[model samples]
Target: MHEKLTIDIETTGLSNQDEILQLSVLDTMTDEVLFNSFLKPSHIKAWDEATKTHHITPEMVVNAPTINQIRDAVQKLLDKASLIVGYNHLNFDNRFLTKAGFRLPERQYDVMLKYSEYIKEPNKYPEGFNKTPYKWFKLVDCATNLGYDWESRPHDSASDARATSWCYRKLAEIN
Candidate 1:
């Protein structure tokens, strides 16, 4: 009976060199926000393109705590949970966390991957051919499909974590 945690991150960019600007995690069973913060990057300035997508500006994070400052607390949260869940954590969020030097738990579930696999139309392809790859869906779209209304902004990490938890529960109920 281990705890399940849901996480989401807002970053400077999509590349490996990019930094995490914000991180949020929630306890899935209790819907409690375990950790959330805006991180100040030590290097790599200018996130114009990423800013356009997440709307987190340099000014917003200028005085925020650096990832190192919060490392211990973040690690404690990570260590407490045996299962980590996120919308696109496998391909996206986890990379940013690892790049920032956090040791993650081995057990993780990607809600995006689950939903992608769940709704896949394998029969649409030829019988002899390999099934098409699972298509990724946006977090907002998953929320919409699950009929979950968001209480906060979309791109914000905390809100996304909440939405991910909501969608995960809905997906679990049916599956």
Candidate 2:
């Protein structure tokens, strides 16, 4: 019941200045990730491995919306969010946002790092689900635990955002 907005960003490069391929977010109540978009790259040479992992071709993004365009649409989503959660934002995504020249409004919580301790503590979950056994529980783990199946593949911003929402809701329910 945490009003958390879980996000996932697929970018052309590792830095904030890099072009963003896609972005998605989910409000914590529903299983669906409500917001997602594919953005056109400002730079012609966005990386390949990053593209491969995300399964987004340059052509697909070439005609896609501009970063500023998508950002305008996403502003509403970001405004509604009480918490901003992602897989690794402090070092990566947030840095990218800084480079993007927009201040991502302060997030109430960073649930990704927080859940490490949630699962690590034996009492955080039911008996036998110990730290070693479930040492690492990503968003999919949370989805599976809560009876929401992860339908899409990973790396892409939309799927990753959906999975992240699932993971967050599960852990939030527990604690």
Candidate 3:
């Protein structure tokens, strides 16, 4: 079987232009943590809201290795995966990786998208016919709702990565 990996990243902001502060990748099939690191930012300032969400401060990353310093290793891990998965990765993590100069694997999966599709509710229309509606879900909220025991705090890269894996497994079982 082809290798499967799950990845998660914590950043300084929400936009693609934001700097990545932490990243985690896990080999899902093997249950091995392939890469986990906190990157020191060189170009962007850490936003207060982002820090509150991820609990990563500028001081915490001050002595950490920059993205450039670990790009090679991260790329290698990504290259080895036949499928790279993440929570909201297609819309968020992938863009940041590309902006930071990392080549992502071709086969990418977004657990958030899958979960949204699985639990989608029909939109209520007061004046017209109803249609399928897509709703955004938080990783922690999804995992807990699916009955998975998610112990790590939300927004931490490693914790999010693990939660993504749990979500993937649960999704697979249902399908």
The TM-score values for the models, in the order shown, are 0.91, 0.75, 0.90
lDDT of 1 by residue, 44-156 (tens): 67899999989999999999999999999888888878999998888888888887888999999999888878888444444433333766679998899889988888999
Locate the minimum summed-lDDT window of 10 residues in model 1.
123-132
Q: Across residues 53-149, which tens digit of lDDT does each residue of candidate 3 receive?
A: 8899988998999999999988888777799989988888888899989988899889988898898844455345213366667888899999978
Instruction: Judging by lDDT against the true structure, name the best candidate.
Output: 1
Find the candidate with the highest TM-score and give its number.
1
Ranking of models by lDDT: 1, 3, 2
- Cα lDDT, all candidates: 0.87, 0.67, 0.85
List candidate 2 segments past 4 Å from native.
1-3, 121-148
Give per-residue CA lDDT, model 2, range 90-129, as digits (tens). 5467776656555576864555555656656434444553
TM-score for candidate 3: 0.90
Candidate 3, pairs of clashing residues:
none
Which of the predicted structures, 2 or 3, would earn the higher lDDT when compared with the native? 3
**Backbone clashes counted, model 2:** 1
lDDT for 36 in candidate 1 is 90
